[model samples]
Target: MFLSFLYQYRQYLVLGVYVLISVAFMIAKSDRVNVNLKSAAISLISPLQKVVNNVSEASENFWNSIEELKKVKKELVRSREELEKLKGANIEIEELKKENERLKFTLENQKKIEFQTAYAEIIAKDPSNYYSSFIINKGKSQGIKINMPVIAYQGNQKGLVGKIIEVSAGSSKVLPVTGVGSFVGAMMADLRYTGIIKGMGKTSDHVVLEYINKDATINFGDLVVTSGQGGIFPKGIKIGIVLGFQKVKYGLFYKDIKVKPIIDFSQLEDVYVIFKQSEETFYQEGD
Candidate 1:
């Protein structure tokens, strides 16, 4: 009997259920208690939401810091490259300054000299040999010839350095005044007494002036200059200074004298070779 009664009320039952759902929804929306329950549920989940947001922001900041570090590293590398370039430029500037100094000195001396000359750089030296003889960078290719007079400007003055004994394609060998076979006709600047300046067999700081007569006054600091007798060297070229005089057993007339070459071979860097002398020089020969 109840089943038969439910069959008859099925349509009403469905309509009543729909009405109940609509009424419950409207009541929840209007009531303050239901609104408070919704607020409480949001409060319970807020801490989790805050933690997730903090993690996201931290990740973003970490990536930004890495990018900043990369930019700084690039800047540092560029700075190092610039510093290296500056260092190279500084070295080039210093080299240019030295070259200017050398050319200036050469030009100043060239004005006072009366003969044609060739500027040559001393390239190689035998330091073990007092540098009495060395090689220059200029040679026959540069109009250099054998027996050409080599002069150097040093100590703020021009002085005779050597003679070109050998010439090659691109270089020349200089027989400096202090060599074993070196010989020059020189005279006392004060007394004008001429003598033969002969080099010792072993390279030495001083050469032997054998033709100085015992009568000629010789002093420890007397300047000696070329006499221009042989026509090989120009007159007024500084030969050396007289250190002392000694009596020898062989020649009683001409005593032995020690003279030092004014050209410091060890410090020789640049030289001028006499390509041609403007005038012929002659010195009176003494017995």
Candidate 2:
């Protein structure tokens, strides 16, 4: 019985030693297996990581381009708005300048006339085919009457423009110096040679002075003015300058003269109507 019990104890001891050796071997190999698995995972995932980086960079670039485009559009809109504002300002400035010039002309004319003068602004012009005449914004209600002489004021110099032919409640028609049936008794400022200035029925560019004496000594650029002989126009009002003279061999004792008017009818704007202070006295005196 003693021998059997000792043999059994020896068998138990050998079994315990075998189990401990197996556990130690498993612990030692665990570290090497884990290292190999980590290496394989890194190799497989590297390509996918590179692809993700490329996609992220492309997305960032697309957003940057969109931002730049929006900025350009905004700049274009701002520039267009500024240009429109500048154009409006320029138009307003030009209108103001015109108004100022008209006022200055009216004030200077007030000093020259003996009677009360009414200022009229030209509102419309007839078509060129009908000759160069204009309508003014003054009428009988403003003491304007038919046959009233209209003169343009240039600084202190008064230039003869035309006369009112038709009058309305608030407007009048002006027959420019160049219109048909227009005539004025004019004289040379230097020589005092009297002549009848007749319209060419065309433009204020030229007028014809008939019945001028051949020996009047009239030359180019000589100043001509209303002689105030017909009791129609004021004395010393400028008509035009002499352009040329023609001598007809078979004609009577008169020569033909071409004249350029002082006033540019095409540019008529503001004018003053001269109302004679003493109409009866002027006509009766035959001046």
Candidate 3:
């Protein structure tokens, strides 16, 4: 009977204890106590909220900085690329200006000559390693024809380029005097020694002067010029300078002399074609 009474009153005892504690808290009625409790609770939770906010703000700031940095890097790369392109264009313009000045000088000087001169720009060059040939902008339509003499110059300093070998509607092919199949009737300006300048199959950037007299006073640095004997090239046009001389071992009549052409073939660009007024008559005869 006693144990049953204890179990039945157990729930009531717990409730009464809670009610007593609430009465005691109300009787205290101290403002300091209430304030202390609220302060403690706020202190604990405020730190947690502050920590969470700080973490979120830091993550947002980090991502924003990354995006901004990427944009800056991209702009910097583009600016550098543009600068390089401008530099290349500037270089090309400078080269073109220099070449134009050279062409103008040549034209001014050629005006004194009686023959008609036509200016043409070099357009293309052969890609073969064994041959030296180039194409010019003038053709048969411009009065250019086969066997026409090509002259290149820089400020009144004229040199032979080659002769027109093939002609088309608007362009012509030039066989340079240094080409393997090219020949020029040349003479030494100092000694008046005449010979045929022949290409040595294209190597070492040199040509051979054949049929030079063994007794000819050919020396290094002697200027060679076109003799105008074949009526192809004009008289007194510079060809090359003598670099060496070698007499044939068994032949006493002739000697071989090596010549270095005045015109730098590797850097050829614009040239002038000498179209004699006689070409019109020659072509009309064939028609």
The most accurate candidate by TM-score is 3
* Order of candidate numbers by TM-score, starting with the best: 3, 1, 2
Superposed model 3: Cα runs more than 4 Å off: 1-107, 110-114, 247-249, 277-287
Please, what is the TM-score per model?
Answer: 0.59, 0.58, 0.59
State the lDDT of candidate 3 residue by residue for 1-287, as single tens digits.
98899789989988999999888778875655653454355334444544565687699889988998999799779857865978647655876999998787766777755568788877666668778877777765687777888888754578988888766556667889999889999999988889999876556678888889888877799999998767778788898999997556776799989999998887777898887744333221100
Show where candidate 1 strays beyond 4 Å.
Answer: 1-106, 127-131, 201-203, 279-287
Give the count of colliding residue pairs in each prediction.
0, 0, 0
lDDT string, candidate 1, 1-287, tens digits: 99888889999988999999878867787576554453354344434544654687699889988998999899779867875978647655776999999888868888977788898876655456444577777766688777788898886788888787766556667888878778888888888988888877434667877788778867798999988878888888988888877568888578888887787776787899888884433211110
Judging by lDDT against the true structure, name the best candidate. 3
Model 1: which ten-residue window has the lowest total lDDT?
Answer: 278-287
What is the Å distance of residue 44 in model 2 from its true position? 99
Across 165-223, the per-residue lDDT of candidate 2 in tens digits comes to 66655666788878888888898889899988888876346988888887777779999
What shift in Å separates residue 262 of candidate 3 from its native position after superposition? 1.0
